[model samples]
Target chain A: MSRPRVIARLDIKGPNLIKGVHLEGVRVVGDPNEYALQYYEEGADELLYIDAVASLYGRNNLTEVVHHTTKNIFIPLTVGGGIRSVKDVELLLKSGADKVAINTAAVQNESIISEVSRAFGNQCTVIQIDAKKKNDKTWEVYVDGGREKTGIDVLEWAQTACELGAGEILLTSIDQEGTRRGMDIELIDAVAKMVNIPVIASGGVGKIKHIKEAFINASADAVAVADLLHFKRAKLSEIHPYLISEGIQTRKVLGK
Target chain B: MTLNAKTISILDYGIGNLLSVQRALDAVGASWTMVKTPEEVKLSDKLILPGVGAFMHCANTLEAAGLNEAIIEHANSGKALLGICVGMQLLFDYGLEQGRCDGLGLISGYIDKIPDQQDDGSARKIPHIGWSELFLDEECPLFHNFSHIPAAYFVHSYMVIPEHSNHVIARCNYEGADITCGVQKENIFGLQFHPEKSAQAGLEILSNFDSRI
Candidate 1:
């Protein structure tokens, strides 16, 4: 098994970094690139950039940010939001993003997943599923940055997306998003068990222990932190050591 | 061939992350040009083939662009040539993705999908995305200054199986199945991962490649 990745997710609106609670009540953080560079220096395994308002605007706005980030940062960068067609995938990939995560467009047209995967290899395509718990054993899928509920079962959609050729699953829990509590361990465990692809748990990382719990209890292959890392509550430098001490494998922190 | 030689050529066949590779080369302070035509391939001191797409389509594109012959001719002339990801797979004799497709045959090997199931009958994920440690099986100059590189980021479903075991320079263990991660045959080299996107360790590898030319 590969080491669990520690990814820093940056939710962007235009050029500024934004954060929200339960995927609502948005506020600016700072320049997206500045945080991205800080995370990169702090030994983030990968970087995820989502244009939080791209779908609402009907087009992606993170291309320039992606282009600039790729020029400066060397870690794997995944860009999502408003990825509607093969051309959109092409544009982002050309802009230097290693992978493109699609949610809203993918739920609308499932074939878009296969199309992008076929054109640019399955590894280049990621399916982002914003899920909210419906009951004890079910979660409803959401699109357009968790604003629209699709009523699709999270497990069912994840399996279908994997079958359709999504290399990885970026599973974000809406109920716990921006709550600064902890990741939905049940949600991550359920999806991680169902899908063979790497599942990145996102949306509810409060402390360093939460990250470790996501990997240990949830069986997540990667844990993505936005509020924890973005707001300066938890540093990746500190997180890596804590994870290593807890017997979880992670990439060596550079310049230590 | 001095160690600090700056000029490098990256083949562009209408696919792959050419700019990322260019940015990496730039970060290493090595001058590079995107080689689109056959003439540019001939004029380049070293060649880097960077790709991120299907195997058959990339092979078809190389044939359509007449890059296949150019790459082979350049390799025959003893100029250093490196292939990244699907670019690395294209250097093989054939690729099994989307049926059997012919490759550059620069190295005697074939590209095939990584085993879907591990030794314990557990499902192994396709694409094998994320960082994995590289166990160097052979000595090569490309790994110079690699003491600090614990792992390089990998994002691929298929891997190359070289016919000659000696050609396999490095191996990465994926759930007990040892997969070939690097191939070296004389001046020809193939890396299954994206060094350009693999942080500082990746930059060191790129710098090593630049120094070899």
Candidate 2:
């Protein structure tokens, strides 16, 4: 098993960092770069910045944020939101992002995954699935930041994306997002089991226990925390030690 | 072409993430420039080859751009030459990614797909995307201060098997298998890990390379 990573995820709308419930009704949190740099200093394993409304606006605006963060932050950075094609992936990767997350474009075309994988190595392509549970055993893929549905089963889509050369899956539970209740353990577990690629469980992680649940219960390679870090409900300093104390292996964040 | 005064030259054939390498070199306080043409390659004393995308495609792009000759020549001249990721893979004689393809052959090795199954016959994650602990096995001065035996950031679906064990400077364990993470033959070195992105440990590696070489 790979070492579990605790990622500080920042969702952006326009120029401001924001958070919302069930992928809607977002409120401004703070500057994306400021929060990102803080997490970097606090020993976050990695940093993820998603342009909150890029899908609706037909553009991504985190290029500068990525540039600014990588200036001093010395960790892997994954940038998502509205990244649709290999060219879009190229832009972010050039701007200092180590990986690019695609959802709307890949779901709409399907072939974009293979194209990006071939162009920039599968390691550079990430499939971001905004999933909402359709039933006890099924989750549907949503696009444009949960504003639209594709009727695609989340498990099937994840497997297909993996076959099409996606390096990792950013599986977010629309239902549990920003709820501070917990992660959609069932959804993440199902997708993680269906594919051999790493699955990063995103959305709805409140307490330190939920983070452990994502690793032990869901087998998530990484857990993305937005609400907890954004609202100061938790800190990565607390999260990393808790995991190790529970017998889970994580890289020692060499921070003060 | 004049071998200008830039301390390091990152060979840019338009395939990999050159900006991050640029940033890392900057953070380590190295004077560097992007070399795109064979003539520019001739002007570089210390060369860093960074690669991404399919192995065959990257090999073809570098060959098509005619930068390989000057790079090989630079290596032959006893100057410091470093390859990162696919750039490191290209130093091998052959790469079996899409098909049998030729490489710079600075070192004797082959680049091939990482086995779908782990050594224990369990399912292994392709691309190996994460930070893995690296074990230093050699005492080459290039790693003199790149020390601390830090964990590194890695992202690739291919493996490089150097023909000689003496060339391997470091190794890392993955799924009960010992994979070569670093190779060095004199001034020519290849690193499977992305030192440019490995946090402080990475910066330390880059800093060591700059100061030591």
Candidate 3:
């Protein structure tokens, strides 16, 4: 059976890796490549580097970071933020990103999803949805680092993006993000059921059990953790083993 | 034991993630280079064909770049050649993606989309993206260091069904079926997964390939 991917999401600001609460009050952590290599060595299934300030800056600045880090880290590297065009996607891929996630640009021009997927394969294009609950069952989509409300229904946008040839969805919950409260199970379940492609549940993971819950309860294909890993509160080595003990298939843990 | 002097040429036929494969080779301490021209492909001791995208487009690009003939000649000369993902699919008789597209015909097989639903009547994800354990159906030099079944990362919607079962070197269980993951016939090898992104076990596999050449 295929195992749920454990991805370490490193939010970048300039050259340093940063962490924030609900995507605010950002604080610098350490070198991005340092954390990335450590995670790769500790058995992370994949690494996601999101430039938290890229959208605001109007250009991607993580290309050099990705190119440098990928030389040492062999696992799949996913880079997102400020990916506004097919040329941007081409630049990041040339810089060694296995996949490029588009959040703001995808919402603005849904055609970019199909454009990137057509130029590259669907596997290369990822649709990232920053969602916040608007009601009991409805979630509103936000863009521009979760600052602007697109007024688009989360499920509707996800389904449309998939129809536009998105191979995967990276669903982030604004309410649960950086809270350590755990993933939005309802949101994940809703989107996973709505789309045929794999959905990666991100935000609000406090412990290893939360990761397992994202997989078992929400049927998420992968879980992306940021605060827990960036803060050194949990290690992937222990997390993978704990998940394995719970009968969750995972990539074999390596190193000490 | 070092491959310092020997540079394994990774064919850049205008598609696929070649950097990850290059990093994997670097991790194994093997020298490598990216080759696009026919002369570069002919000069390398070993070649790696890595690709991603539509099969018809990839096949057509390879043919237009004259990489098809160069790759076939390289394989026929008994030099080691490896294909990953769509590159592996391009080694077969033909691909049914987009339309019926002819492959390099390095091996007898056809590429087709994986079944959408399993026998259990449950919906199976279109692109089988994630890590899965590989069961060695037949021993091959590519997996020499692995003491047991190792999981590798896979991201694809289509699968290669070789003409001869003996060519299948490894299989992985997906949904309710055992899908072919690796194929080996003579010096030519094909892997449907991204071993470069598969962590340490994948590094071992790349090291094995490097050592064999």
Candidate 3 chain A lowest-lDDT run of ten: A247-256
Give interface RMSD for all predictions.
Answer: 1.2, 1.7, 1.5
Model 1 residue B130 lDDT score: 83
Query: Native-contact recovery for every candidate?
Result: 0.70, 0.54, 0.71
- Per-prediction CA RMSD (Å): 2.0, 1.6, 2.1
Writing each residue's lDDT as its tens digit, candidate 3 over B14-116 gives 7888888988898899889888888878787888999898899999998899878889999999989999999988889999999899998989999999898
Over 4 Å off, model 2:
B1-6, B146-149
Clashes of each: 0, 0, 0
DockQ agreement of candidate 3 with the native complex = 0.69
Query: Candidate 1, residues A1-256: lDDT per residue as tens digits?
Result: 5778999999999889999999888999999989999899889999999889888778997788899888888989999999999999889988989899999999999999999988888888899999999999899999988899887999999999999999999999999999989999999999999988899999789989999999999889999999998889889999988999999988877664
* CAPRI docking class of candidate 3: medium
Which runs of model 3 end up more than 4 angstroms from their true locations?
Answer: B1-5, B147-149
